[model samples]
Target: MTLVLSACSYRYGRVRPYVLRAFSYELPDGLTILLGPNGAGKSTLLKLAAAVVVPQAGRVSYGNLSSRSKEFRREIAWMPQSITPLPSLTAREYVAYVGWLKGLSRTDAWERAQQALRRVELTEQEGVRTTQLSGGQIRRVGVAAALVHDARVLLLDEPTAGMDPRQRRLFRDVLAKLVEDGVQVLLSTHDVADLAEEADHVTVMDRGRVLLSGDTGAFLVEAPEGTAPGRVAEGAYTALLERGEQV
Candidate 1:
C-alpha cells in the first residue's frame, strides 16, 4: 500500500502568513528517506502522514483509503522525533504495551513484541529496563514499539539525530534488513550520510516545502563541483536553501 499525500499543507503558528506551502508525493515501498536541516518541515511531513495532525488543506491517503479512518490507524505506525519509553518497563514490556495499545490481545502483544525487538536487534536487551539502555538502544526500542503491530507504513522522525557513528551503522543495518523483509520505511533526518547508501528514494525539503524527490541511485553518483560523493546531498541541500527555494 503506497502512502500518498495530495496537496497537503500545515503550519506551526496560528498566523496565516506563517503557513507552510502545500506539497504532495506518492511514496513508494522500501526505505524512503526524507532529508533536511532543522526546521525544514521534514518532521511536519511525517506528522501529517501519521495523521497526528490534520492538514489545513488537502488529504493524506493510503492507496485509495483516506487517512482519517480507523483503518488508517490500524495500517500505519508512527514514531515521533521525541519518544519517551516507560522508564519502569523493560524493553520488551514497552514494546508489548505499544502493541496492546494498537489493538492486539495480551498474548499476541507479547509474541509480536518479541518479534519486533528481534527485527531491531534488541533481543538481548529484552529484559533490561529502558532507563538502563544506551541512547541508540532506546531509539531501537521506539522503533520496535512501532513495529509491534505489523503496520504497512512506518513513519519515523529524525530517529538517528544524536547517535554515534557505530550506533548509526547498526541502526541502518537493522533498517536494511526490514526493507529486505518488505516493510516500507519512511524516515526523516537532517543528516544524509546514511541515506547516500541505504535509501531507495530520497526526498529533500526545506522551510515547509519539498525541494526535490527522486531515486537514490542518482544521488549516489559522484557529485560534480569537486565535492566528496558522500557530501552530495549536503551540498545540494545548502544550495537549494541558498536559492531561496522556500522563501
Candidate 2:
C-alpha cells in the first residue's frame, strides 16, 4: 500500500498557523525515516496520515483507500510518542482491546494480541499491568498494539524514544520482519545515527516544509566527502537543515 498525501493542510486552531501547509508526498515502500527538528510538524503529518485527525484541506490516501474510509483506518496503525496506559489493564488486554477497536472480533483480537506481543519481544511481560511497566516496556506494548491488527502501514512517532541500545536493536529487528512482510512504515525520529542500516528512504522536514527526500543512498550522498560511515546520515541531515535555513 502506497500512502500518499496530496496538497494537505492542517492546524490546531483557526487562529493558529497551519502546521502542515500544502504538504504533499508519497510514502515510499519499506521503512522510511522522517527527520526534523522540534515543532517541524512531523507528528501532525503522521496523525493526518493515521486518520487520527482530519485534514483541513486536501487528501490522505493509501492507494484507493481514502482517509475517510473505515478500510483505510483498519489498514494503518499509529503509535504516538506517548503511551498512557488505561488503568488496570494488563499489557495483553490493552493490545487485544486495541485490536478489537480496529475491527477485530474478541477471539481473533486475543489471539492476535499474543502474536503481536511476541513480535515486540514482550510476551514474557504480557500479563503485567501496563501501569506497572517501565517506560521502555510500555513503548513495546504500544508497538504490540499497533501490530495487533496486522496493519499494512504503520506510522510511528519516536517509537524508540525510551529504549536502550539493545531494546532499540530488538525493535529494529521487529521492524525488519514487518517490512519483509510488505508493511509500509513511516517513522519520525531525531536519531539519525540509528538510520544507517535501517532506513530504506529518508525525508527531511523543517518548519512544515520538506527540505530533502529520496532513497537512503541518495540522502547520504548529500554529505561531504570523508564523512565517517556512522556519521553520514547525521552529516547529510545537518547539511539539509542548514540549506533549508538559508532558503
- Using TM-score, give the best candidate's number: 2
Show the colliding residue pairs in model 2. none
**Per-candidate clashes, comma-separated:** 0, 0
What is candidate 2's lDDT per residue for 66-176, written digit by digit as tens?
Answer: 999998988889999999988789999999999998889999999999999998788899999999988778988998899898888989999888788877887788888
Model 1 over residues 70-126: C-alpha lDDT tens digits?
A: 788877889987777678999999999999988999999999999999999999999
What candidate 1 gets wrong by more than 4 Å, as runs, is 16-19, 220-222, 244-247
Candidate 2 whole-model C-alpha lDDT, 0 to 1 = 0.90
Which stretches in model 2 have alpha-carbon errors above 4 Å?
none
Q: Can you list the residue pairs that collide in candidate 1?
A: none
CA lDDT, every prediction? 0.83, 0.90
